[model samples]
Target: MREVVRAASLLIVLCSAFISSALAAGRILPHAPQIAFVSAFNNSANLYLLDIRHGALRPLTQLPSLQRGPVWSNDGLRLVYESNAGNNNINLFMIDVRGGPSAERQLTYFSFDEVEALFMPNRGQTPEGFVFTTVRGPNGDIFMLDVPPVGENNRPEL
Candidate 1:
């Protein structure tokens, strides 16, 4: 009986800790603006955000390079995507969802192309980072990038 009681108490404590942590993470916006999905027309593609609630559309990226595969950050405040950058080399870049002077920044500058990037979903697993496929000739491998924390004005430690 004592063993069972102790087990039950431990379970209750663990469950409560999980619940509180989740609550502390705060709530995701019910209708945050969605990702920019470029549409193909006349062989042209550009980033655009669509607000389904109000049937509104806004252009987010206007660059000559081909942009594709946009993934939102865990906080939903930023977006990371791939751009060819007219150098025949695809690289990763980020943009703030909200318009501002510090809206855009190039995240990766590499001769080898990186694509299909995805932000780590679990905050605990990757405090600030993402993973993607790096293409190098006939060989390809998965790589992880640890992003710098916001508002720190410091470079990523590679």
Candidate 2:
């Protein structure tokens, strides 16, 4: 009887520890909306949030667009993707990685817009910001923009 009681106590203690740890993490995740995108239907991509607690899925983008590649910001607060939404060419857009519609902010708009900014981890962020390549006449040019602090949006400081 004593051995059985000890086993039961150990089980209860372990279970309690797990429950508390889970609850603490749950409370902290909502602040970011936690999201991931997947192919929901034919030729379309949709984002879903893992409830983490219930394992429930939530929809993000609904309209059909050639969505592929998910890139996260250094801070993990933003996601950049390529999609066919208004422009005929591939464009770069940023979104809140957490959840919701997370409207994309277009990074470039051109007749043959190509997102030249995303270079993955290898493309080191310079003292300014991201180094970019833009077409000029028949040749392509390389440029750099210093990363600015929040609330300082203006034409690239060049």
Candidate 3:
């Protein structure tokens, strides 16, 4: 009877510690906006969108590879990221946030890795696209890519 009581007490203490640590890590507020982040599972990293207000999580990518550095366009309609798919060279890919994984389009096919992508603002008479750094040697090179129109999946001209 004493052993049973001790086991129950240990279980309760463990549960309490877990809950305390989770709370200390910070909770998503009920009114918080949605956010996109990457999480790794089973040796693969994928993108996910969290609806903070409702605490709903939706995966944005299901590829069996590493995807990271997601950045939103100025209008928030699309996201560009880097993925090490097809030969393990991290290249840029874009997807319409509302269209899910089926709308993902490859944006770069360079031999080296392209990362740190960000959308350039389209001010009055300015062209809009994303700029990224290509990792080759000790120092990487920055390149700008023009975004094609929606529904066009062809690779953008350099």
Q: Pick the candidate with the highest TM-score.
A: 3
CA lDDT, every prediction?
Answer: 0.66, 0.48, 0.69
**What are the clash counts of all predictions, listed in order?**
0, 6, 0
Candidate 3, residue 118: Cα displacement in angstroms equals 0.9
Worst 10 residues of 2 by lDDT: 21-30
Clashing pairs in 1: none
Best by lDDT: 3
lDDT string for model 2 (31-103, tens) is: 4434344443554555444433334555545657655445455565555555567756665555665544425
- How displaced is residue 157 in candidate 3, in Å? 5.6
- CA error at residue 33 for candidate 2, angstroms: 11
CA RMSD per model (angstroms):
14.2, 12.2, 10.4
Better of 2 and 3 by TM-score: 3
- Residues 30-53, candidate 1: write the lDDT tens digits: 336343555433344556665533
Residue-wise lDDT of candidate 3 within 1-158, one digit each (tens)?
Answer: 67445544544553465453231111122233555666666667787765544546677888898888788777666678889877789989887768744678888887788888978877844446778888897878888888877666666544
What's the distance in Å from true for residue 53, model 1?
0.9
The regions of model 2 sitting more than 4 angstroms off are 1-35, 40-42, 49-54, 99-103, 113-158
TM-score of each: 0.70, 0.49, 0.73
